[model samples]
Target: MIQAFYLPNVAQIKKRYENNVQTLLKYPFLFRKDFPDFDSLSVQYFPFDDNGYIPFYKNENRFGSYINVNDPVIDRYFFKNLDKPILASDVYSQYQLEYLNDNVRKSEWVGQENHIYLHYTNWCNFCNFLSCLNFKQLLPDKKIVFLFEEEISRYPIDFKKEFGIDYSQYQVKPIGIREVNRLIWHTQLAAHNGGDFFNEIFYDHPNLLVFKSVMFKNIKEIVKNLRRQWKQRGKLSSRLETELARLRHPTDKDFLVALFLNNACACCDNFRFKNSKLQPYSEQYSERKKRKKRSTQKRNDGISR
Candidate 1:
């Protein structure tokens, strides 16, 4: 069971540092949840202050992956594979903070938006919402990614012409949503190694934490799906439940969900590791993939016939 400390409290501070940021000089990301014994696994999250506290993302690189700032996030368990901290002076485009500073200005310029807020509760929502919007709204200044989802592409040209909100303003660009999510996972893992891994990867793009609810729902759904698969395979449902008790103390909600959702565990989404409960998910995924291929082949055969 993954119990995440979404904010930097005295407890979490105790886990990560022997001294404060002033002494350690480690710029704190949103909240270092994973800090496993002298810098190991820390929870997933976006670095808001580089050293302050802003918790509650609501899932992705599981300080539990969360929103920019609202509620606590889901638990992320990644490790550092680096020799230094992620926020060294060398990497940023030009220690100028031009891009990020611009967004803060835009927030001030555009002011507090009456923007319709859409956030994720699970990883599948991240997948589903991104599928619907095509990732145009992942940017820091986006005002209407969720709004774009409502528009269907019947005749996009005509539709754009009909709407006064210039097609250019609402362009739905393509992006590798899956790839980005993986980066979220890796960066969170790197925090334990002192955050230097970030310098290794994000020289051009500074990692902006993504909407958390999406990742949460995505993982929750995956576990649930896995459990369902196991039941279908005619395995004893109680077997996974037994495993859950062994892995996680009942006090933990994350583990409880693991136990409950274990019955339906399918595949790990953004986070790679899977609890024992959903081990059967792989077998089910393979079987389903084969069935899909076979069905497609039959359709081709019919066209030939």
Candidate 2:
């Protein structure tokens, strides 16, 4: 059996200890042989410097091979020096029965269908605002629960006052990466900016909606689209909504096992799993010359006319 150590980004470990701990517990099965007494393994925390890099663990350690769940650039450094450099997805094919069993208990958090999960970070505040506003207009009855990376105060605007929305209508809470996983597992619907994190974890979720920050060209266009969607479909059905609500809640052991197997077997984009070096683009000056010639000919013809 091949044994590998799981190395998450030290910054993430420091910021979200609880969530990282859960991931450490659940995701170790990605390896063939478990680290000796894996449950009893103690983690040591280190402080990160200005660039979010830990200077201490730059060299190879006693841990034979390793699987990393961090940015590709950061992983690349380890890959260059490490004995065996396997990406996180490389080991995702393995599943442990204990982890699947544990997921069933975790799924208990899945509850009523009335709550809508909204994921936003400081980077994409405008998209978050638009998503919340649109959802409120479309489904006034549904409660909006905003999940953030840090404290709600870090956001630039007060969502209620800025949008003229009531505070009673929504709730804001800061969540860790692991909590986001559990919330996605149980929530009725998740509206987010289509970040890589959401794409990876909630890959199979049915009721996930993504709004692009760059798509906000004009208010009129946004309103027109929102109204069009609302007119076409009045609202989600009670039964269908309830069904989506229940899908996240895995009560039965068989369902949990099946889901775990599906996740393990599912294919992800190969590019996401590896850090491909940037390649230089060949010049297309010939195509540009042809286009310029055509433009000149058209202008001359217009003048002659």
- Compared with the true structure, what per-residue lDDT tens digits does model 1 show for residues 181-265? 1223333443267555443333222122222212244655655554455335444246444554365333334333443333223
Can you write out model 2's per-residue Cα lDDT over 126-200, one digit (the tens) per residue? 221121111222122223333443433423333345545444332222111122223122322336545656555
Worst 10 residues of 2 by lDDT: 85-94
Q: Give candidates' CA RMSD values in order.
A: 23.6, 24.0
**Stretches of model 2 off by over 4 angstroms after superposition:** 1-33, 36-45, 49-51, 55-225, 232-305
- Model 1: lDDT equals 0.30
Q: List the residue pairs that clash in candidate 2.
A: none
User: Which candidate number would show the highest lDDT if scored against the true structure?
Assistant: 1
